[model samples]
Every structure is written in C-alpha cells, then in structure tokens.
Target: MSTPHTRRSFIGHAAAGFSTLALPRWGQAQPATEPAPRPAQIEHAVTAPVAIEVNARPIPAFEPRDRSRTRFGSLQYRSGLVLTSPHRGFGGLSGIRVDAKGERFLALSDQGSWFTGSIRYSGRAMVGLDDVEAAPMLNAEGRPITEKRLWYDTESLARDGNLVYVGLERVNQIMRFDFSKGGTRARGEVLPTPPAVRKLPYNKGLEALVFVPKGQPLAGTLIAFSERGLDANENLIAFLIGGPSPGQFSVRRTEKFDISDAVLLASGELLILERKFSWFTGIDIRIRSIPLKSIAPGALVDGPVLFNADLGHEVDNMEGIDAHVTAEGETVLTMISDDNFSLLQRTLLLQFTLVE
Candidate 1:
C-alpha cells in the first residue's frame, strides 16, 4: 500500500500513448451519474468543470507466447496491466464492480470518489480504457461527504439492482445510494450498520461486501467482511445481515494477509482478495474462494488459496476484485490496485481466469 500522504498535487500532463476525455464529448451515452459534489472542507478550491480528470495509457502485454502454462493455484493469467494518473486524489481505490456484460465498471476510491468506465481489450489482452469518469461520492445534501468526520476512506461497495452500498472504513458506516433515481438527485443516506461494525478498529472495518442474489444459499443477505477485525477465537470476523443467515461468521486468516475485497461467484462461492506488506517483502497479494454452503453462523470457513502474486508480477497494492463471465462462458476475475495517491505506486487493473 502506498504510504498515506496529505499534500495535494495534480499531474495533468498525460505521458505518451495516453488519452483523455473532458466533458461534453465525455459521458455522452454512459449511465447517468451526478458530477462530483461540492467538496466538503477540501484542500484545493473547486475551479474546474471536472472534479477528477483521467489520463489513460495502454499496457499491451500479459504473458509471453512461450509462457502460456503459468498458474497460481487455481487461477491462470488471462491478462493484466497497469494504470497511472497524476490526479493526487486518484489513489486509495478499494471497491469495484463490473456490469453484467463485463463491459462497463464502477469503482470507489478510498479518498471518497467514484470511477466508472469501459474496459478496453485487444483480442484477449486488456489494451486500454475509454469513457472514463471520476467523480466524488455525494452526500444527501448534494455535497461531497468528505467533510464528515473521518469519512473519506470509502472502502467497500456492493450493488443490488439500483441500490449501491458503500462502506466507509474510518467512518465505520454504510452509505446507500439509489441509482434508480436519475443523475443529479441520487444523493446518499446512511444505512444502519450492525453495532459490531462500529466496535472494530476504525481502519480495519468493513473491507468487503456482496449481496446474495435471490437464488443463492444466503439469498437477499449482505455479507460484510472486515479488513482485520477478529472474533472471540482470533478468527477473522464477518457479518451476515438482512437475510436468513443474519449473525456473525468467521474466516480463518492465513499467511498474514487482511481482506481487501470479495465477490460472489455464480455458483454461490465467496472469492476473497487479500494483501500483505512488510519492509523486507514489499507487497504480496492473494485470493481464496470458499463455498457458500460452508458459511453460516459462527462457521469457521477456510478455502485453498486460489492465487497469489507479488510486486515481481506487476502488482501494486492490489485491493479491489470482482468476477464476471465472458460471452464464451468463462469466469474472468478483475482486480484493481489502490495506489494510495503515492507517486511510488502505480494503479493497476488485472484479469485472470479461474481453472478449478
């Protein structure tokens, strides 16, 4: 993870092979979303029409021709690449979701912003991105909620139809926004989080969440996972809320990584994204998928680590993960990194196919 910094600097210069789209021509036909709201207690003055300008560049390689057999547990490389923008507020991305078609995507920045765009691919490898828009998450008053107490660290997101839930880490609260309402008026209202959520360490609270679809084992349930919160038995704590299995659950933590994000597979399994870092080891990331049949009240769920990678593999602070199926009926997992707005780190978007 990039070290947290306080200074603000916007790198507006796009390097070679980069592309940008400002208003009018941008967001022409995409989903309607409000502009970044009036920033609350922001550091810089809001002087531009766009709150966050995106600079996208192409990254054309995944694996070499002779190295097609590469595997990490049950995951095989489909394609992966890096994304970098000089928007000082662009880092700390923690939540992501791709549309049913796997074409459009929505993600949340830990610093309190929303990123939406189309994923560009060349044949099978991700080549670049287009139609990108980054805006601040708005409060009920039509203002950026960053002004609220310890509220900027938006960490987890889940979508159920038009309802979107965002988990703010430091704030230990869930904000609900109804996208069913059109663009300019979809300001958010806070949801009633379980009392257990507020008791977790502020920084490690609510790192991942996913809504159980109507046909799933825990149908209509919302499973919220913490970054590092523990149970009475020292196991990682998760909450089962708003469905048949409403209570507390646990997932065994191994290899010293905390949960970063998670996704619900079509078969009702939970795929977890985790990361670990140390001065000597730099950064390491992994994924573990457990069956929903095994998740219940007080259940200790553990699954084989499906994938693991490090900085050597072009991975940065790989924090966001979501799964989608391609037209060919293959499970493609997409992951993105939170650069923490630090110059030393590069925001990355990666894709892989699960072989098991």
Candidate 2:
C-alpha cells in the first residue's frame, strides 16, 4: 500500500530548498585529554543478580539489519509509547519524544552539545515536515534534518514537563535544557565522569542518564551511568553514581551495580536489562530490577528478574531504555536496538510489561 522513501527521494526535496540543509557553520574540537585508566584490571566480577520477580512476559525477537531504521543509539517512552529512530546527521531519523497529547515529537540534537529542533509524528511512525522546524537553531542544515550524532551511546527526553537532557559521551557531560518556557537553553550541567571516575580502567566514556523520582530515598539526585569496560565484546555491567550536580557526584569504588541499558522505574527502582550473547551469534534479552537506594559505589548487586527472549538470538546493538505507566495504570518497559549501520546490525524496538 505504501512505498518506502529512498535516499534519492529523501534528498530530492532538500535540494529544492538548498538553503535549508546546510552544514554546521562551525565545527568544535572535542576536549583534548586522555581519560585516566583504572588502577587495576577489574576482576571479572559478576555480582549475584538481585531477583526481580515481575509478572514475566515476552515480546517477539528482534532481528536487526544494516538498513534504514536499523542503527538505534538511544530512545525514550512518553505516555507509554516507545520512540525508536536514527540519532544523528544522515538525513535519517533522530530521537522521539511522546507528548501529553499522545503525539510523538521528533527531536534533533544537532546543537553539537546544545539542543536543536523537533518533528511531530504524523501517521503510524512517520512524521510530517510541518511537525517541527520553526525552533531556533535546531539542525546543522538550518532545516529539518535527521540522522544526527548528538553523542555516542546516549540520547534523552522528558515527559510531564519541558525538561530535556542529552549526554555528551566524548566529554562525559550531561547538558540540561529547559523547554518549559520555550527555546532550548542550558539550565544546568553535569559531568558524568568526575576526576576520580576517569581513573577507572577502560573508562571509554560515560553515556546513560535516568532521573530518579524526587521524594524517593534517591530523589532529586541524578544518576549519571555509563557503559564502560575493557572492550566492546567482553560483557561489563554499567556503573551508577548519584550526583546532585555534574562536578559533585557520589563516588564509592566499592558499590558497583550491573545492568544493561540501565533505566529507572516509576517507583524509584532501577530496571536493569541483561543482554546475553550466544556462544556463536544471537543474544538473549533479560530484565532485572534494583532499588535506587541499593546503588552505592561498593554495594554488591544481587538478584535480577529475567525477561525472556531467545537464547543466543542476536539482533543489532541494544541500547536505550525507558519505562512509563500505561493508560491502564500498568507499568511498561520498552527497549530499542542500535543498528550501528553495520552489516551485522538492525534497529530493534522491544516492549514488555514489568511483573513485580
């Protein structure tokens, strides 16, 4: 019934409005400093996964490929819907934010480190040009552009308010922008890796941010988490830290929590997704839970609720996680996979109901 738009078709319209899709006028150099290495090799320590016996349910297995809608970097869920799309500059899709009206807004983070523009979803998952574009300096092209690399392994959006946060993995900083009034402006900032955190071995960089509910034991404190370790192959549980501000973070070497795609729950608990790779190829996706208060630098992580997928079933790079309350007042957890645009990857969006 519908035909997919090709690169030619996508760019043809841009060529008409030549002034729109312009490159960033200026390019900023990344911070020039080598990250400090961890003191010693982290012993391959697997903390006992804490049991998260939720009402277990499974979603269809996702097979990612290196096509259009395959490379997923980060994602979010607003009003119980998942937003999955491309992240940076390729005329592709950026991230998505579901609004209060149950409408999905396409967000572009071409601000380099600042905030950019947004697009509104029209039918199904596709959006119209009029959806976004009037915003200030949103994209590098000065027009509506997708496929942007805001940061590596990170992207963010907020619901119930005009708050937006983006993680700059390279510099390990989180830029906070307020949409409450309008126009994206940096209201505050936080550096994920403090001087001490930079000392961790293979601290490639920090890249995940999940806000803990205020009033909870861990409320008001932002959790600056990361997907750091030896190599991309070897498995490493992400680390979590409580920070009231960027430079000032709660650092305790002893408390380490392991969870894949670290996400915080509505109840102030942290949901950990474990990606089990098959001996040969495929990956098994599982879910585990932990209380926000249980996260300390030295606190050992034990017990994890296992969300089911096929064992050894591989997809693309699975990153980004967000939880929302469904219209029925039920809690739902959704996930998206990063295609990486690699011949070996595909964009996958998986959803599940949390049974605890």
Best by lDDT: 1
What is the lDDT of every predicted structure here?
0.74, 0.39
State candidate 1's TM-score: 0.83
Q: Mind giving the per-residue lDDT tens digits that candidate 2 earns over 1-356?
A: 11222222223323322333333222223345955433332111111111111121222222222223321222222211222323232221223333323233324332332223332333323222222231222232232112244333233333324656655444455555555633442233443444644543432444455655566665555565444532233333244444443332222111122233556665767765544443333344555666766665544444445454432233233555565565676565545554333222333444445554
* CA displacement after TM-score superposition, residue 44 of candidate 1 (Å): 17
Looking at model 1, the pairs that clash are none
Candidate 1 structure quality by residue, lDDT tens digits, 1-356: 32221111111111211423211111223235856534442312231124344555543333332254567678877776667655545656777899876778888888777777888877877777677766667788766677575777789999998888988888778888897874313678998867988998868888998889988898988899999998877779998978896888899988788999999999878999998866556667888889998999878999978887765555667779998988888898989887665554567788888887
Off by over 4 Å in 1: 1-69, 86-88, 183-185
lDDT score of residue 125 within candidate 2: 32
Q: Give the per-residue Cα lDDT of candidate 1 at 98.
A: 93
